[model samples]
Target: MRKKLASLMAVAAASTLALTACGSDSGAAAGPENGDKKELTVGVFAGWDEGLAVSHLWERILAKKGYDVTLTSADVAPVFSGISTGDFDMAMDVWLPETHATQAEKYGDKIVELGTWTENAKLTVAVNKDADIESLDELAGKADMFGNRIVGIDPGAGLTKAMNDRVIPQYGLEKMDFVTSSTPAMLTELKKATGAGDDILVTLWRPHWAYDAFDIKDLKDPKGTLGDAEHISTYGSLTFKEDFPTLAGWMKDFKIDDEHLFSLENAMFNGADTQEYAPIVDQWISENQEWVDSLTAAKK
Candidate 1:
C-alpha cells in the first residue's frame, strides 16, 4: 500500500513539474512580502472532482476580487501536509469523521477550519439501480452476480482501507476479489458496466459527479460499517486567517447544497472533454449569478 501511495506521489511530482509554469514549484507561500495576501495557493486532491470543482470556483471568485490564486494538485495526504506546513494556503475538500479522518488526525492541529460547505458527503458501495441486491449484507451471497469482485479506487484510499478492514470481513466477502486502482479506471469500468447493462459493484462516494452521471444507487449498509453522512469542509494553514482575513470570513460563511454542487460538477465533468475548468466555472457562475455573488457578498 505504501508503495502504491509512493507511486501516486511520484505521479503527482511529475504533474507538479508540468504545472511549474502555472504555480509555485516548491509549493511555497508566494506573494508580496508586506503582509498583502493577494496571492494564495490552494491544494487540490487529484481525481477528486468535488474538490477540483470548488477550488476552481474559488480561484475564479478570488481572481475577480483581485487575488491571484494558484491551484496545486496532489494526493490527499500531501494536500493535508501542504496545508500544515503552509505550502498551500487552503484546500476546499476535507471529509470529516471518516474518509479523511487519518489526515485530520495528523494535521488537524496545524490548520484552521474554514467551515463546511456541504454535508452530503459519504463513502459508498454502489451498483446499478436495477441490480437485484439492495443491501451490502446480500452481497456475499450474490457475489457471483457482480463477477465475484468489488471494484475500488486508489489502494491507499480510506474507502479501500475501510473495505479491507471492515466491510469485506464483516460482510463475509473473503472469497471475492477487491480490485484497487485509480478513480478514473474505476469510473471507466463503471461506465462500461452501465453502458453494457451489467451489474457492477464499485466503491463510490456522495456529492460526486458519478451519482449524477451514472444510473446507480448505494447499497444499504445496515450495520453502519460504511459510516453515516459526513461534512465536506475547507481547511487552511495556521497563518491563513492572519494573511487573508477577508477571504477567511467569506470562507467561514460559505455554503452550497448538494443540488448546486452537483450542477457545477456535472458542468465540469459530465461529458466534458477538456480539463480546463475556468470557462465552465465562469459559465456556471454566470448562470448562478445571485448565488455566486452571495458567496463573496459584503458581510452585513
Candidate 2:
C-alpha cells in the first residue's frame, strides 16, 4: 500500500510538469491578448524615400500605442527576405504588378500583404525638364546630350533591373552608360546636372519628393517596358496577423495619397539638416493630427 501511494504521487508530479511545459510552449506562440508581445520589427528598404517616410511614421504611431517598434533598414532583396522568414514583422514599400514583382514571386507564399497605401508608383528614366529629348525612343540618339550615361539607383533595385533587361534593349540604348550607385549618388548627380543647367538622365520614380525638389520630367515609355502604375503595398511576415492583430487591422485600413505622402517625404528628406527622423516624424504627425489620428481610430 505504501509503495502504491508513492508511485501515484510521482505520476501526478510528472503529469503536472508535463502540463506546465506544454503551457509555456503554447503561451510563447500566443497572441498579444496575453499582454506579453509588444515588440515589433518593421523592415525598410534603404534609400527608398517612400518606405523610409512611412516606416518612420508608423514607428512613431505604434510606439505611442505601447508597442516597442524597431525599424530595420536593408536593401530591397534583404527586406523582402526578412519579411518572408519572419525576421521582420512588416515592410512598408513593396511595389507590385511591376517593381518588386521578382521579390513577390520569390517570397509570396511565405508573407502576407496587408494592403496598398498608394497606387501611383512607377519606374522612370527621368531627365532634366529642359532636356531636348522627350521620350525613351529619342534617348538613344541624344544619349550624348546627357553625357551618354544614365544615373541609376541601387543595383539591386527593380528599377535598375528593368532598365538593364527591358528598357535598354527595347529602346536600343546599349551604348549609353548606366551607372548603378546609391539613390543619394543618383540624386547628387541630378542636383549637380540641374544646377549647372546641363541635360542629364537618371532612374527615378513617382510619389518621390524629388519631383518637388528638382526640375525634372520622366521620359515617355511608348513600349511600356517599365510597366504601368504600381501599388505601394505593406507586407508582413506569415504570422504577422496573429502576432500583431492591432497593427494588422490598422495597416489594412491605412491609405495615404500622393499629396500627403509627398509632404511627409519632403519633411523627412528634402531640406532637412539632419538624418535624425524621430523628431521630424513627430512634428509631421502633430501637424497632421486629424489624418494621423484617423489611422488609429479603429484601435479603440
Candidate 3:
C-alpha cells in the first residue's frame, strides 16, 4: 500500500484521515440500530487534501444508507492493490488512462473499475520561485540548477515512475538524479528550500496543499511528459460492492464540482474548520436530490 505521491498530507494526518473511513466500520461493530451491514475501510491517495473530506463525506453518506465505512490511506498504487486483495474496501480518486492504467491493464479481472469520480487532476514539475526554472528541458545540462537531485515522492507512486521514466527522458534529463522520499519528507525539503529562497525543483500534482501553500509554479512540460490533465476517478475490490451495496453504489454515482471539492480541500490543507464544508456539501446533495437519487442506485 505504498506509493510515493506529491502533496499527500503528513503521515500523521494521512493516517488519521485513512482511519476516518473506518469510523463507520467501528460503529457497525457496535451494532447498527436498523440491522444494517458491517463497516468497511476505503484506502485513499491523490485527490490531495480532498481525500479526507471525500472519505468522511462517503462515510456519512454510507451511514445514512445504513452502512458503516472506514477510510484508509496509501500511496496511489497500494490503494488499488489493497482493493484488489480485499485488504481495503474501495477508492474513489484513481486518475484514469494514466495514473492507474497499468493497474487496470494488469488487474482488471481481480478488481472492479468504476467510472470517473472527479476530473481535472494535473501532474507536473514544480520549482521554487528562486530556482527561476520553467521547463523540464532547462534541466538537461544544468545539474546545479536543481542540485542534480530530482526530489520525488514515494518510490512506488505511478507519477513518480512516469516522471522518472517517461517525462525526464523525453526531456533529456538522463544525467540528473532522482531521489525517493515520502510525501512529508519531500515537502520538508520544499519547505526548507522555499523558506530559504534556495533552488529546488520537484514533482507537483494538482488538488494539493503545496499549490495552495507554496508560491510554486508548475514547470512547463513541452513534451507532454506530465500527461494531459486527467480525470481522477474510482475503483475497488469486488467485495466493496457486495458487502456495502447501497453505499458502494452511491459513491460510484457521486460527483462534486471542482469548486465544491477544492473549497473543502483548501479547508483541510490549512486545517481550517470543516463543519461548514460538510453541511454545504450535504445540502448541495440534498437540494440536488436528483443527483443524490442517481447515486442512490444499488448497482451499475
Candidate 4:
C-alpha cells in the first residue's frame, strides 16, 4: 500500500512540473496555472479583409475562455517568418495553393500549415468594364487604353511575384511594369480612373469590398496564370498546437463561407472603424452559432 501511494505522489509531481514547464510567468500567475493566462498572438495583414478578424477569431475566442491575446498585423514579407518562429502564435490569412505556397516552401519545417479558414477564395485579374478589354492578353501594348500597368499589392506579396514573373510574361508584356502598390493605393487608382472614365487594369481578389463597390470585370486568362480558385487559411509555428491544443484545434475546425467573408469584406470596404470590428464579428458568430458550431465542434 505504501509503494502504491508513493507512485501516485510521484505521478502527481511530474504532472505539476509539466504544467510549470508549459507556462511562463504570465501563463502561470492567473487562474488555472496551465494555460489560463496563456496569451496568444494573431497576426494579420492589411490584406486581411476585416480589421477585426484576429480580434474576433483569436482574441475574443481566447477571452471567452479566460485567456488573453494580442492582435498585430504581420508584415507581408515576415508573416511566414513570424509564424514559423512563434513570434505570432497564429495567422489565418494564408490564401493558398496560390498566395502562400512559396512561403510554405520557404518555411516548411518552421511552420504548421493548417487547413483553410475559409475555402473558395479567389485571385483575379480585373479590368474596368468601360475599358472593354475582354482578355488579359489584350492588355499588352495598349499602354494608353490599359494604362500599361498592373496595379498590384505589396512588393512582398507572393501574388505580386507570381504576376510579375509569370502573368506579365505569359501575356507577352515584357516591357510593361507592374505597379507594386497596396490594396488601398490600387483601389484609389481604380476609383480615380473610374471618376474620369479612364482605363485601369488591376490584380483583384475575392472577399474584398471592391467587388461590391465597383463595376469591374475579371478578364479571362488563357494561360491560367492566376490558377483556379483557392482557400485563405491559417498557419502557425511548429509548436502552435503543442502549445495550445484546444485553441489550435478550434482554429483547425473553425471556418467561414463565401457569404460570411463577403459580408465582412463589404463592411470594411465601405469604411467601418477598426476598433468596433471585433464586436460586430462576434455578434455574427453568435448569430450563426449552429452553423459555426457544426464546423468548430470537437472532431472525433
Candidate 5:
C-alpha cells in the first residue's frame, strides 16, 4: 500500500511539473496581447500543507482576476533556487528567522520578501493529548513511554536538522532513536498511534492541519532549544514587485491569524484530499467574502 501511494504521489508531482511548464509557455504567449503581465508561477514546497493551501488559494484568487497562476512543487532547496533564478514568481510560506534562514541568506539578494502574513509560527515536538509528559525536559526520563523514538519528517527539512542538532543534544535525547520519513508517512504513523490511544512523539509545526485534526499538544520547550516562535512570510523574485505592483501590494497587506489559518487548513486538509483544496478555498472565500475583498482592496 505504501509503495502504491508513493507511486501515485510521484505521478501527481510529475503532472504538476508538466502543468507548470505548459502554463508558463501559454502565459508568455498571451501576455503581450493582454497589455499586462498576467501570469505567475509560484514555487511550493512539497509535503508542506500550509504552502499547498496558500498556493492554491492564490492560484484561484488570481485566476479570477485573469492571471494565469501555476503551482510547481519542489523540495525546499530547489524551490529557493527556482525563485532566485526567476523561474518562479513567488513563494507563499517561508518560515523565517530560523527554519529558512539558510535559504534566505543564500538567495537574499536574488529574492524580495513582500511581507510576513502569519506570526507565532512554531516548530515543536508534540505528543498525544493523553500523554503524561508536558515538556521536552520530561521526555528523556520517560523515553520508553514513546518507544524511545522521535518521529520526524523529511531529513532535508530544517525541522529535522534542528531536531538532530539542537533538540536532541540539549534535552539529552541522543539515546532515543529518531526516525526519518516523509511528512505523509509520519502523519500516517501519528494517526495509527493516536487512534489506538498510544503514546507518540512527532515533530510538528503550527499553522498545520494536524493540530486541528488530532488530539495533541506541544511538549514545552523550556530550554529554548527548539527556538522561539517565527513568522511566515511571502517571498518573490527580484522583479516581482516591478512586474506586478498591485498584486505585490495586495500580498503585502495580506495577513491571516492563527484562528483563520487553522480553520482554513482544517477545511482543506483535515478530512478532504489536498488536491481538492481549490474548491474548498473558493468556498472559504465566499464565507469570508469581506476578508477576501479586504485582501485585494486597492491601496489608497
Candidate 6:
C-alpha cells in the first residue's frame, strides 16, 4: 500500500471519534453470544490471489456463522488505509516486517496485527530455466538476453519499489527497461516467453502458482537487495478485538502452510476458467472440513 500520510491522518481523526462513540456504550454492546453487529468488511488487494482466496474463504466461513461479510477490492495502499480508518474490519494478506513496512509504520497506531499465517514469503526475480543468467548481478551485462526489459507488476507494489530503488542500482541495471504492469500482464509475458523457449525476467513472489505453472527459477541475489523472507499476516482495525473478540482471537490463531495455500490457489487460478473461485474455494473447504473447523475452534 502507498503511504498517504495526510489522508491516513484524516481518516485516523474520524476513526478516533467513531471509536470513542462506540466505547461510550460498552454496557449495551453486543457480544458473540447475542450476535449483534454480525457484519464485517474485508479489504482485499486486486491481483493478489492469496488474499482473494483467504478473503473468500473467510467470507464463506463467516456466512456460515451468520455474519455478513463484504469483500472490497482495491490497491494495496487503500486496503491498509481502509483497515486503519475502520472502513474495513480486517485484511488477510499483509506481508510483514518488509514488503509493507512503510504502511505498517505509518498506520501502526490505527491498526492491530492479528498474526502471521503464511511463512517463508519472498519476493523474487524469476527467469525461465533456460535463461543464461543465474543471478541478479549478471543481468546488467546480458540485458539483451532477456530483451533488455524486466517485467514487473503494479508500480505501487513494494516489490516494484525494491526493484527500482535497490535491485536496479545495486546491480548496475539502470539502463535496462523496467516495465510496470499488472500481475496478469507479467504472467502473460512470462508464458509467451517461456512457451517459445525465449528468455524473460519478471518480478514475482513466493506462494504464487506461477512456479508450478511455469518452468522458472528465482535468480540468486548475492547482494540481498530484494530483502529477506517475509510472512503473510492478518491485520485488524484498532477496535476489532473489542468489537469481535471471539473472531479476533480465532484470527490470531489462524495458520496455513505453503502446501495448502498452493493447493487452494491452484484450484482458483489454474482452473479451466479463472472467474469461478468462490465455488472452487467452497469445494476446497468441503474437502478440508477438518482444517476449516480448526480455524474457528474455541480459543484456549
Off by over 4 Å in 4: 1-38, 46-55, 76-82, 95-103, 119-122, 128-134, 138-164, 172-181, 192-200, 227-230, 273-276, 279-300
Residue-level lDDT for 94 in candidate 3: 67
Which ten residues in a row are the worst by lDDT in model 2?
1-10
TM-score of each: 0.82, 0.75, 0.63, 0.66, 0.80, 0.76
Candidate 1, run of 10 with poorest lDDT = 1-10
Q: Model 4, range 80-147, lDDT digits (tens) per residue?
A: 77787777776777756655667778888888876566666666778788776788777775756765
Query: Tens-digit lDDT track for model 2 on 36-81?
Result: 2577887766556787788888877765555666777666667788
TM-score (C-alpha) between model 5 and the true structure: 0.80
Model 5 residue 60 CA deviation (Å) reads 1.2
Write down the lDDT of every candidate, Cα atoms only.
0.80, 0.76, 0.65, 0.62, 0.77, 0.76
Compared with the true structure, what per-residue lDDT tens digits does model 6 show for residues 1-300?
Answer: 221001111222221100111233343233235333666778876657777778877776766665656777666778889999999999888887766788889999999998778887888899999888899988888999988999988776767888889999999998999998667678889888988989999998887877868899999999999888878899999998888877887788888877677777777787447554556777989988998898987657
Give residue 99's error in model 3 in angstroms: 3.3
Best by TM-score: 1
Give a tens-digit lDDT track for model 3, residues 153-187.
Answer: 87766668787779877887777888877666787
Task: Go through the candidates in order and give the clash count of each.
Answer: 0, 0, 8, 0, 0, 2
**Model 2 collision count:** 0
By the lDDT metric, which is better: model 4 or model 5?
5
A best-first ranking of the candidates according to their TM-score comes to 1, 5, 6, 2, 4, 3
Q: What are the RMSD figures for all models against the true structure? A: 5.2, 15.1, 6.6, 13.1, 5.4, 7.3
lDDT of 1 by residue, 95-116 (tens): 7766677888888799989888
By lDDT, the best candidate is 1
